[model samples]
Target: MDKLALTFELSYYLWGLLTLTIPIAIHLLSKHRGKLVPFAHIALIKVKNSPQLNQARLTQWLLLILRLLMLLVACAILAQLVWSKNADTSANLVLVSNDWLAQSSDAEKQQLFEDLNSSQNSRLFIIDGLNQSLSQRKLESKALLAFQGDTSSTTTPPLNIWANLAEISKTLPKAQKIQLYTTNRLNQFTGQKVAITNPIEWHIKSLPNTLPETKLTASLTIVSDANYQQQLLYVRGALDALATTLPLDLNIEYLDSSLVQEDLDLSQQQSHIIYLADAPLPTELVNSATSIISSEQLQGYTQADFPLTLATKLFAAQTKQWFADNARLSNQQITELPNLDLVNQQQTNTGNAQSLHLWLILILVILFMTERLLSEWPNKHSRQVEGN
Candidate 1:
């Protein structure tokens, strides 16, 4: 049997719904202050002892509705209200990958598709290495009918879908359970193993199969000035330690003290360069390097042609000055790959509901402007009539 329910992504934001009363208060205040004030005509006009409810005309209904809609939308956005077929934590959200489907029989694939398509209680999503939930909108349109899953590509790219179910779940409204139908690839699970507090219930489609693998390989170069040799050794040792943990082909090179950033070999396939200096690195090293030298940092906002980053501190046990730099370097290098982000991810609601809020706020602003115009229409009409 199919189940249906509506849920809020951020139930906490429902508290903002209390603000709806503000518009009502404003409407009442405006009416109370609409009391007639006369000077020359005061002698002819009689002041009523008791104000009647009918005395306050109700012509601003459109304006009131517009203002009310703005508040309602704001509250809806804050609440992140979404309609879920099943709101249970146990509700199954199945993320299917291409590799898993490839190993299955045609009959089995058809059955899986029919079952998911028939069930209103579960959602079927398509996933691959480079994309997650390829046809989210398309799936919704089809009434969420599951097939073996859609073809995500012309060629099945090598996949390392490590904890991909957990990532997709984070983006979805919090549910009781999630499952990934995939083959076990070691690359999918290469990140540091920590017990997931809210782990995805992994459902293996078949025994693990080996996919074509890619290694993180980079050549490193260091300034060979005698003054920085000791620090350079620390950097080398740290790089080697990082290299051992993954499939990395590392090559080392040296730069003379007189060598400038322009002296760097631009044609080399090395992905990164390290500049060890007492001062900041020159910008030209980024140009001569085939590898992008920039990282996601904000020291200097200069946009370089290649990925460049100002060299960060590399701490060794021998140096008591800064030991945490080792951890930073390790983390930065791993992020150049996948799966590591999950191990380091701080547990929070994974869905980005900000876009929801943004769209609602935009509508609310438009409604506010319309409401203002509506409220002034009567005044404008009155002025024109008096002038005629």
Candidate 2:
């Protein structure tokens, strides 16, 4: 955890070890004094027998002292009193799943692949190539060739982002989590606002003078019949380059089996536009029909500087992917994702301080009661003197 916690834990250990000495010392001293006998040389020895030195009294004191020491040692062990470096020997494996649906272009996909490949000891699973099953197969090891064009699944499957994530989680080493890369599409899911606990870091190369917030927008139109009557429709959002083009009056049906029609039209600036017609759609679809048409390229989103709307979107996508992978099995498990070290450190320090305070109070109370008992002890000599 933190230095504070480390210090407190060490101190408790010291206290525990030291406390053991208290009972041992008391036992040794008590055993030695137990042999002391009263001599008949009364002229040289005028000291009176103290109440604390009686055999029964000494035995009682020794028992109490030893009991206290035992309690202290027990408490320390439960508190993790030892300073250890062995805990760090544990290594964690995180499986990262990347899908082609989220990639804006070939170049973007390549860049994303490069990022994923660069990670240390990560297993990559690519889901878009020639052989459907083969393309979706998980890749093991660090070979660079396996990452480029495996001639796998040609058809892009419906984005089963969560299910794919769950598969990755099952493949990963137990106790390790699977990390899914998703866009800012989470807002459509959970209605709650979002915060950036952990934001992806990107060092974009060959970007077209685009700021982190740069976004491109496209409008789609739907025509139901020859009369151009509007109807319920579904729309998917996605992005393409400036030069890339799609055919006009394109006919595409939604996966929900809705009788919707979409037409791609060029904007005044020659940008692609999506048109929908006779769209039989449901408003409460699980996945967002709206695609990440304009993937907002950015440097980074931070906990302090990121917008709530964007954070919500990113959180939704990431969290959804996380759950699909069964990685969120510990969703209720302390999710201080970004600042784990800081949070753990704080908790450990607090626990140690509380322990120390409790022990100190116990010691003080014992000492106070011992002194009061000694002060009020009865005098045996005075009783004998009065009777004579």
C-alpha lDDT values of all predictions = 0.52, 0.36
Give the CA lDDT, 0 to 100, for residue 324 in model 1.
20
Each candidate structure's TM-score, on Cα atoms with residue i matched to residue i, is 0.38, 0.28
lDDT of 1 at 77: 78
Candidate 2 regions with alpha-carbon error over 4 angstroms? 1-16, 32-69, 81-139, 142-144, 148-388
C-alpha RMSD values across all candidates: 15.4, 16.1
Looking at model 2, residue 101 earns an lDDT score of 30
- Model 2 agreement with the true structure over 1-388: per-residue lDDT tens digits: 1123332354545544555667667666755544657667685976788664574565466556646655664656445443322211122222232332332455655655576667654444543322344225565534322344322322222343333333333322223433443322221112222222222222212112212121223333322343222222112212111213222232333222233312221122222212232343333321344432222321122323333333333334543443332221121221213343443342331211223445555665675566455434435545665799
At residue 174, give the lDDT of candidate 1.
45
Candidate 1, residue 335: Cα displacement in angstroms equals 22
Runs in model 1 with CA error above 4 Å? Answer: 1-8, 29-56, 77-161, 171-173, 176-188, 194-354
Scored by Cα lDDT, where does model 1 land?
0.52
